[model samples]
Target chain A: MTVELASIEGQRPDGQEREQDLSKSPLSIRGLTVTYGEKPAVFSVDMTVQPGQMTAIIGPNGAGKSTMLKAALGIVPPVSGRVQVFGRPLEEQRARIAYVPQRASVDWDFPTRVIDVVLMGLYRELGLLSRIRGEHKARAQECLERVGMADFAERQIGQLSGGQQQRVFLARALAQGADLYLLDEPFAGVDAATEKAIISVLKSLRAAGKTVVVVHHDLATVAEYFDNVFLINTRRVAEGPVAEAFTEATLQAAYGGRLATTQVSQLAHKA
Target chain B: MSGEEFVPLSLTPLLIGVFAAVACALPGNFLLLRRQALIGDAISHVVLPGIVVAFLISGAISAGPMMLGAAGAAVVAVVLIEAIRRLGRIEPGAAMGVVFTTMFAGGVLLLEQTDTSTVHLDVEHALYGNLESLIWLDAIGWSSLLDAEALSNLPVELPRMALTLVGVCLFIAVFWRALKISTFDEGFARTMGIRTNALGLGLVITAAVAAVAAFDAVGSIIVIAMFICPPAAARMMTNRLEAQIGWSVGFAVIAAVVGYVLAGYGPLWLGQQDAVSAAGMIATISGLILALAAVFGPCRSRAGAPAGV
Candidate 1:
């Protein structure tokens, strides 16, 4: 189920190519760079996320994986670059994309129930002056059920376990009704069962022709879960089919001295 | 201490406390949810200078000018905090501390320069409000036919403070779900197209309006007590946002009544020469309630502490 880096080169399935239709480019990035004040986190990253694909951006710690995702969403203003979603600029297409920030980024103890959190995904559709109506509540409940969280709708978000919280977030994303989904470290703290649940949802999203871009840490599951992979450090290490682009050489380049080349090569061979 | 002395339906303080409690609690819920609880304290304190400056310019403590001054100062405090956070690379607490302390000090200095004997900017008076005086204040006139009848009878007119508080509370009640969603998960809110920033600013403005309404009755220092205490206490007793709001209003009304009655009768009952201030007593009671909640409230789960932990 794994993809070896060396075998991926030219064998990238035609289905995996970035959709050629200009009208279908769900996300486009050109020379995107993100810096924290003075320190550069992601430098010169170029990527195009197209419809009907699961794009996993993979890298070692401090490789700017999350930064690239944030930059693409305009959450972090890129130092120098442009990002477009569905041929429109980020702000123009904000409603068409949903973002799930790292779970750690928010305050868990905040006084909000799971249903309330899920209803947040309906805000853009509902607008500010309007309230969440009966239909919105029904939709929220349906989304919660999709993620196996319907029973927990009335529970406070802080009361949920880690895996349950992750499911709740996924449910919120499901309720967003966006064309593009951006998830930062969705699998970081989850159990194997939770991972399976997440993968199934992502697969369904791709099956439905939506675009999914995830910041992933686990190399073993990349090929099994994603159609394409973007290997990144401070710069674009490589990007293509999971089998060809995610090689020992690319992993070494992206991870630097942290991961041994032989270990990556073996993992690639095993794929 | 006869039962006759305690009128459950007293028109003045009861109505005033009910309105004020609802208004303050509505915005207070958002503030607590946003973890910006202390911003209320900062705005209340900084507005002192704005009030003094407005009084000096207008030569009178008109409600309109004083409210504008206080709101302007609140905006200034927010801007200052934002600037300090940006320029100094300081934490939010540090930034808020710098802004509130500087503005409060400036207000005190300005008050000292004015004719203190005639234009008294008493710190004690500002911190806790004189709720008893609100009973003597004129009632506001509403344009409706029913309101005209209510006004013509001079039937123990509802104090202006109570009306203002009730209006604000109604606004919060109407937007309760939106505020809760925005406060809890802003990123999701933005994605859902909630105009998260506008909602955030609205919450801040609501806090400012509540603080201003409370300033004349409770004084600036203790206004924060009303803004924070009821919400804090309610947080412990409920998991639902609606329940929290209800509990906060309930707690606030109870505290106000007990504080008012105790301050009015404490000296006579204890045979003490000095009577306690009602505003001071209200704030003290609120603080006690908050303290009790903090100590006895169910402990928040420590599992899955964020990455940096």
Candidate 2:
């Protein structure tokens, strides 16, 4: 599997011109460091997400996986770093990107309907006056259909189950119609049906040539879910196709002694 | 109440109270749903110091300088609260508690030390504003409604409050979607280029302007009450933002009109001589409305939770 990964990576022409005049990685971060107080939260980490690929960033607890993602998007200010999307500054290219944050980051009990939550994705086009015509509602409804949440459009958000909430968030991301999708823990705490629904939607997104980067756990699903993987603790561990980068050595380095030997052995044997 | 008497004594103050209630309640809906209801409380408390400082600097009770001073104090309080929360690594609730309490106490001290006796400024007046005294001096009867001279002689608070309401309405109308989106999910709002931080500050500032304007006409008590009670009661009645806003405005109008009338006439009917404080009565009525909604509103309980919240 590892050899196959290396060969597939080698086969890429490496400059497909992508959506830009010059081919560039969809996301590129260099020497990024973020700090909360005295101690650094995420060190001088670097990562590159190639265009039109499903990539995963994996690490142990408190490994700053979420922080790194946040820094790339400027959600949390980085102490020292530079990030680019499609080879330009993030701010300039923000409209071309979509983000799905963790469910816990928001107040679920907020007064809104599911359709309204999805409609927020079109805020850029709607602008100040937002004389929302039927077309915007139709678009939101279509996004909800993509995530199998069409029937839940009129439902109050607070009444949703955890899995249903996750689907609604995915539907919102889909409504953005963006070229690049960055999701933080889209699968955490979701049920199996939701997991399958999310993956299928993500696969369709990739099939349509959109770039996807997810901060993922559940190592058992990594081989099946992602083609590209980046392992990190405070800094980059290894990054490449999952078959090549999802090695025992990289896992051990990322998780340290905190990872059990049997778990590592099972993952190795599973691969 | 005869039209001859009511037109002169009650019309202007009633309009001021209603305007004040609606203005504060409009933003209160968002703040309450965002779990930032206490921001209104904090802003109202800090406005006292702003008023006192305005008087000290300009040595006048004019509206413009007082409004500016109140706005300045509100900004300072917001900055101080954020500084304490970030620098001290303290939770927001505690930081807000510290800042607002200390600022309010300082305002009381300043009020005592300063010779504000010549003006209508005092701690008691600040808490329970002289809502009753804001009467139309030139109003004669129903004809006054159409008489430009009578209208010109209307209390200054009437127009000032109307303008404040218009400002609040315009802000909400222009930024409705952004405010709704950011209040729900700030991260997603940021990702969408919504300027969540600026919008958050803008929201607080809007609340501050409403608080300062309302505080001048009604008092801190009604400002605080209108900020929390109307929106909270409205929250109990619905799950939709539009519906919640509508209900809140309705509730505010009810509290203002009903509370003012009850304060003015209920005692008269009970064989009493003077009316009670309109500010305190409005606050009390709004609280009562909140209590009734809490117990009986259909959407009051947490979704899928047992019996009571």
Q: Model 1 misses residue A31 by how many Å?
A: 2.9
User: How do the residues A1-271 of candidate 2 rate in per-residue lDDT, one tens digit apiece?
Assistant: 4334433565322244333322467899999999987888899998989878999999997889999999898888899999988766888777778899998898888888999999988888888785889999999999999999999999999899888999999998888898899999999999999999999999999999889999998899998899899998988898999878888888888998987988976774565
Query: Could you say which candidate leads in TM-score?
Result: 2
TM-score (all chains, Cα) for each model: 0.84, 0.93
TM-score for the B chain of model 2:
0.94
Chain A, candidate 1, TM-score of: 0.90
lDDT against the true structure, each candidate: 0.75, 0.89
Tens digit of per-residue lDDT, candidate 1, span A1-271: 1223322443432233323322357888999988997889999888987577988999889889998887777555678998877665677667778788888778778767899888878766775467668999999999998888889998887778788899888888888887789999999888888888888998888888888999999988887788888999889999887878878888888888988778788767755
Task: Output the number of the DockQ-best candidate.
Answer: 2
For model 2 the interface RMSD, in Å, equals 1.4
Native contacts present in each candidate (fraction)? 0.45, 0.63
